[model samples]
Structure formats: structure tokens, C-alpha cells
Target: MTDKTVLTERNGRIATLRLNRPAAMNALTADMLSLLGDELEAIAGDKGISVVVLTGEGRAFTAGVDLKALRDSGQDLTEGNVGDALNGAARWVQQLIERMPQCVIAKVNGFCFTGGVELMLACDIIIAAEEAKFGDTHAMIGLRPTWGMTQRLGRKVGMQRARELSFTARTITGVEAAAYGLAMEAVPLAQLDSRVDELAQAIAKNSPGSIAAYKDLYRKSENAGLDAGLAYEYETKYEIADVRERMAEILKRLGG
Candidate 1:
């Protein structure tokens, strides 16, 4: 499925969603956010797709919300209606991606700023290209982030580093992002696509039902205390059927 702003391509059990606004650095306008949300919702219902990769068509994963679009809309921020609508749509997209049963990977090939960073945080994993740039420029633009950036950024990196990055609005290289625990890893720019594909295929090879259950359990555990998380995990394990059969198959494959 190809839209003017977003493109979706499926290869077997994996789907790739590309932000198509290369000239605009794949900035998220309100319309683009809505389109992305629709696409993601469709993917969530697709039982055939077990993995989703999100990237950009050009030099940026996304530059974040389109400031120019907001400006041109002549919407008064003080009134809050327009701003709230845009933020609400962006939030819905993030939540949809986060709650989807399929594993979502952010292929950060280039610039990822503000809302883009928030979008990446919502994914299950992020693999960035070495030359990719990341930043939170909300403070620099005289606006506070309406998305989950404030909370997610601090959680991924330490609060101190998050504070410095947001306050200074300084861009970090992909290498620095990995070191700071923002990205899973940074690879050579030339190998970014292949690396993401490899990881996605690895994930796709697993049992979809088990993977979905684990993804949901992990999300639930993140918010629960250790004791509660442990209890929840223990209880959830019984929910998966054919455990013994699957284990036997694994052992047989290993020649046990």
C-alpha cells in the first residue's frame, strides 16, 4: 500500500513502512500521522505479518512534526484545538505501534528528531545507521514535547543525559545513541537495510503466537514491580498451549 506520504511493502511475513516525504525529511504532518495510523491499524489485523520495519525513503527516518505545516495552517496554539488534534493523532499512532502484536523495528537510517525519536521509542527495537542523527529539538523551538519524548527519552537514557540532550538540543550520532542505550546498535550506513532485514527475518522465524504473547507480557511487566512482574510472568506462561510439543520439537531438531 503506497500513499503520498507513507508506503507499505510486504515481503512474506515482514512488512516495511517507509516515510515517503524525502524532500521534507519525512516530517510528520497531521495528514501523514493519520495515514500512518491507518496503515498501522491495518497491519495489526494482518495475521500473516509477524514483523514490521519502519524507515524512511531518503535522508531521514523523520525530522518530527512538520513545523512548516503547522505554521501554514495558521492555527493558534493558545486555543489548543489544532495543536491538540495533531498531538492526539501522533499519540494514537505511537500507541497503535506499541500495542501491535507484531514486532516493530525502527530502522533509523538518518535524522530522527523530537517526534521521530518518540516514534522510535514506541518500537520494540531500533537499529540505527552509524551516520544517523538524533536529537530532541523541542526546547530549541520554544515548545515542549507533546508526545512521549519527555518520559521515554529519560527512561531509555538516564535522566541526566536526557536532560542535557533536550536542554541543549544537541544532535547525537548513532554511535553515541547506542552507547547511551537509545538504540540497540549502530551499524555502517551501507549495511543498515540488510542488518534490519536480518533481524526482522530472525524474529519472523519464531512462533508468531509465542512471540505475540511474550511481547504483551514484556510490555505489561515493564510497568509492574519486580514481584508483580514475576507473578505475572509465571501466570502467563501457562496460557501458552502446546508448550511440551514445541519443546519436544526443539529437542528433536537438536538431536537430543
Candidate 2:
């Protein structure tokens, strides 16, 4: 599990997972995908970790799926679901990233295209270097997405923008991605790490119980009507272990 294709590092309450095929532009090989999933799975259950940042070791966040590697393995990329073709690595990893309890951030540093876009879309927050590249090339190869690309992309950006990018197979900078609502923000590459670290630290300071509930509630609200969503939000029962202590601390600070 400690192979170079994927690497995991921990700092206090935060965990960082890096894709490590720099030579191949950190292409998403089967092993890389599976290992990434394993790292996420472990973090999901780790009470110590409140956040995870996903990025690449070298130039790219990831160049996307390694089609050549899949072809060499006797898989038909043009066939049914690409996930199925790759023996479920694509679908599994992305799903794990999205479903995991920890808040996940995709720290897009460089080139991110096709399946790379799919992978990042699974994260709760995406921030990138302004110079980073992003595109959806599924149309270029006449392939449909099976890794939640179509669904998540449309949700991240609007359906119109998603279709435009997918159909054109055109590349856009991280700044453009932010404008398109694909990434929440983009900063100079030099500042990306510090910016992401700041964000992760802020999130880590929050009550884990409340944050987990928020994640679940927001996801569920997506499918419900306004009335139902509001009702769910109020009626939902989520206990914050630190609620009493936090309130007392605030009162003391205010000299109550």
C-alpha cells in the first residue's frame, strides 16, 4: 500500500494524499486509483483526521485515466462503463472520495483533464493554481463517463457550461474554472499550498460532529424540495460533543 503511485501524509488533524506518477503526469493507473481509494477509506474511519487534501506530487494533479495502461491490460476503453472496463477502480475511488466522512479538498496544482476532472469533482472543495489546466475530453474520444463525471460536473458547474466543456474538449485555466464555478477559487501556484492549508486548518477547527451532519444534510437536501429540505434541516438530530464547552468558552471570553 506504500507504493509510489499514491502517497499519504498526515499533519495534526489534516491528511494529504498525493498522486505520484510524475513521469506519466500522475496519470490515473489502476493501482493509483485503488491505492488512493485505500487511503481515503482509512481516513474515513480515522477519528483523528478531520480534513484531507488531494493533489499531485509533480506537474499535474493528474492527466486523467491512463488509457494506454488500460489498453495494455486488455480492457476496451470504448466498451461499456469505463469503470467496469477498469474493473471498477474509477468508480470506486471517486465514490470513496465523495462518501468519506472527512471533508475532502482537491488541490489542483497543474494539468487536470478528462478523468482527472472526474476525480476532483468528487471532492467537497476544489481550489487550484490559476495556471492549472482543466478539461473534459470524454467527447474527444467518443466516450461517456461512468465515474460520476456527467452528473457531478453538471452539478459543480451548470449543465450548459458542463456540456460546452465536454463537447468542445477545450482546456481552461484554473481562474476560468473558478469563474465557471468548477473550482471555488484559484490562486497563484506559489500560494496554492498556503491557501489550501489555511482552509483545511479552519475546517479542522470546527466540530467534527456538526461538520459530518452538515455534509449529510447538504447531500440529502439536494434531492428534496425546498419545504422538505428546510424541515429536514430543523428536525435532523445531530449532537455536537463540544457544544456546551464551546458556549461556555465564548461566554467567558465575553466576560458574562
Candidate 3:
């Protein structure tokens, strides 16, 4: 088997990104993050692709940062080089998921912990299998989540729950994760693939421009205060107003 950190493939309108380091449980490295960013950027400009799904090969989605790589770096986590190498992947992948036009989905199975959990939170939709486990074990390992975990987790599952999860660094089952709103849905391991395909196909059938706008709306709303969100909605509505006008003109020309 290949040992690349990342792999990509286009399946008709759906692009699949697989984390391929299964021997290490797909623990992320800096190169993987850069590759994923490059892939997302490429897909953004490819009209043939309409949606993107992120998953991992073998038993785990990802085991977070590569512990062995950290040891090999011979640099303290507090230092610039090793920390940058370790965390940069998470940063770039998170940013790519946020800015990409395609509908991003996390098809998670097995261990989705620490950075894996943070990365999934970046996705627009997360669908996990029954056997998957989600957690933030950073604190347990004498580290803290420096990603957007503190901000996004609470918005996902509420402040109280986020505090409990991050502070305790406990593992939550896929079903419990679904209940906490961490996942969009949880399916049996056997049916997970079909469910992801069904959802991806449904998303791919929608207007690409409309889907992009919808995803942006969530991001803006998530970061905005009530008043600011309302203002953003108005601005977005004004922007889309032109699309409606053009649509009407097209229908008129067709004598519909």
C-alpha cells in the first residue's frame, strides 16, 4: 500500500479526499495539510466537481497529529519549527474547508479525536459510522487544543457541553456525538458509505452558485453577533438579487 499522507480522486461530480497514512492511523503531518489545501484549491476552480468528501483509509479517519513525527522533530512543542509543522496542517485544512466553494462533508469512521475532531467541525456536514469515536484528548496528553476548537465546539454543541468535552478530554461515541449536534447523523458502519453518497449526490444536483452562497451564509452567521448577522443577511440578499433578476430575464426570453 502507498504511504502518502493525502490522496484525491474525482468521482463524477463528487471529489473524494482520503487521508492515506493508515499505518499510523492517518495521523496528520504538515505535508498532508499542504496537499489537502492544494487539492481543495484545485477543485474550487474545477467546474466538473460539485462537492467534496473527506475521509480516511483503513480503520481510522485520523489519529490527530503524528506523535512519532513530533518525537523525530527533536523540537519542543513550544518552539516555532515543530509547532508550525504540527499545527500548520490543521490550520490550512480548516481554512480550505471554510473557503472552498464545494459542499464539504466529513465521512468519518473510527477514531476522530483531537485535531480530527477539529477538522470535522470545519466541515459543513459530518456523517459518522456507528463505531466511530470522537474526542479531544489534548488535555489528557498535557496539551491544549490551539485550533478553532474552543470557538467552534461551543457553537456546535453549546458552551457548557464544549467545556465538558474539552476539559475532560473524554471520548464520545458516534451516537452520543449526534445527540450533541457534533455530527449531522450517525449510521451503522455497513450503511455509512451509501448515506454519504446519497447526501453528496443530492448536494451535487443543486445550483453550484446557490450552494456556495448557502455555505458562506452559515460562516458569516456563525461569526457575527445578532445585529451584525442581520446586516450580513441584508448584504447577501442584495448580492443574490442580481441572480434572481438574470434568472427572470432568462425565463422571459424562453417565453415561460
Candidate 4:
């Protein structure tokens, strides 16, 4: 379970996953990605976990993938094994986020760049501290965003903004990211923890099945046009009510 690189804790209705390599600003390692993938799968069907928050152990959220490890391993970043390894790890993380039943949120604080941005993009919601910074450093680092960042970033912040971030490798503050729709909100560092908790709790109180259905719809309709989205909405019209049926039964049992 690569506890050194990643840590997980169940907090009532919320499950918090932490990137634990603080010495290197919690850079994503291959083992960490693998463990995270497995953990997400394990909790996918757990009704106890209504929300999941991905955060860092110390100061920075993540500096991105571990470049030193790849270089030292003599990995061929040009083509072949290196590219495959990097792509595979990134995909694992993305798939984990997509498949998890829990509402995934990114609690960002300081330096989120390159692969870091890719990870945050995977989250359903992102809450950042004022000190947080986001950037697509692939161009500057001589690498490319092959981890669905190109696909998702544009959808989140528009193509023009995406190009500017990826090509120019310019950093954006938390407030700027929020304004650009990259982050849900930017709070003071002191308020970051409480804000994440507040958001998670608000989500946790909702019916799990309803939340899951809505999340699924959001993912499917993100790229859909108005007509297609309308069809999807109509198809899932009774989703919330269907899940609420059991609520009445539970209330009856409680004599509510």
C-alpha cells in the first residue's frame, strides 16, 4: 500500500487521501499512483464513504511527477517505455477518480503544476488556499500533457485559457484559478481545512445514490451538446426521486 507515498483515513462520511512525500512536495511516484488506484477501487462501493478529499500531507499539494526518479532510471522520455509508464500511471489516477463512488475533491494548497494540474483536474471539485498556484509546466519541462489534461483543462477553463497555461507554462494563483473556473473557491490558508470540511459535509448529507447518478450524468454530459444533454437529463429525471424512496421507509421506521 505504499504508505510512505500515500496515506488514507476514513473520517465518518468522508475519506481523505493524502499524498505523503512532503520532502519533495508530495510528488507523484509510480507506487503512489498504483496504490491510489487500488484504494479508489476498494472504496468505490462503500456506502460509508460519501465524499473523498485528495490532499497533501505538508505544505504544497504536489510539485508534479517525480522527474528525478525517471531521469535516474534512465527512462526514455522520448518514446517507448518511459512514455508508456508515465501515461499508464496518469491514466490509473484518472480512472480511479472517475470510478470512485465517493464525490472526489481536491484540497489544493501551494504549487500544483504539470502532473499536479492533471490530478486536480480529475477531482469533481477543487478547493484551493490563497497560496495555491497552478500551472501546466510540460512545455517548460520539455514534456507534454498526455494525461488527459489537454482534454479536461479546456473543458474546465476554456481552450484559449488552456493553451495559454500549457504553452506559456504560466502560473495562476488560487483566486485567478477560481475566477477562471479551475477551482471552486480560494480561501485563506487558515480557512482551507474548514472550507474543505464544510463542502464535503454538505455533499455527504445528500443521498449517495442521487449524488452518484448526478456525477455520472455530469461526466457523460460534459462533452454533450444541448440536445444530447437534454436527452440525458430527461432520461435521469427520476434519478433523485428513485433514490429518495428508501428515505421515506427509513423515516417511517424512525416514526418521523
Candidate that would win on TM-score: 2
75-145, model 3: which lDDT tens digit per residue?
A: 67653233766577678779889878789999998888888888899999999998899988888777767
lDDT of 3: 0.85
Quality of model 2 by C-alpha lDDT: 0.87
Tell me the TM-score of each prediction against the true structure: 0.93, 0.93, 0.90, 0.90
Which model is ahead, 2 or 3, in terms of lDDT? Answer: 2
1-256: candidate 1 lDDT, tens digit per residue: 3448989999999999999999999998888999999999999999899999999988999998888888888878664233876888899998998788899999999999988998999999999999999999987777777787877888889899999999999999999999999999999999998899999999998777787888888887766888998888788753556577889999999999
Task: Report lDDT per candidate.
Answer: 0.89, 0.87, 0.85, 0.84
Give me the displacement of residue 11 in model 3, in angstroms. 1.4
| Full ranking by lDDT | 1, 2, 3, 4
Error of 2 at 114 (Å): 1.0
The TM-score measured for candidate 3 stands at: 0.90
- The residue pairs found clashing in candidate 4 are none
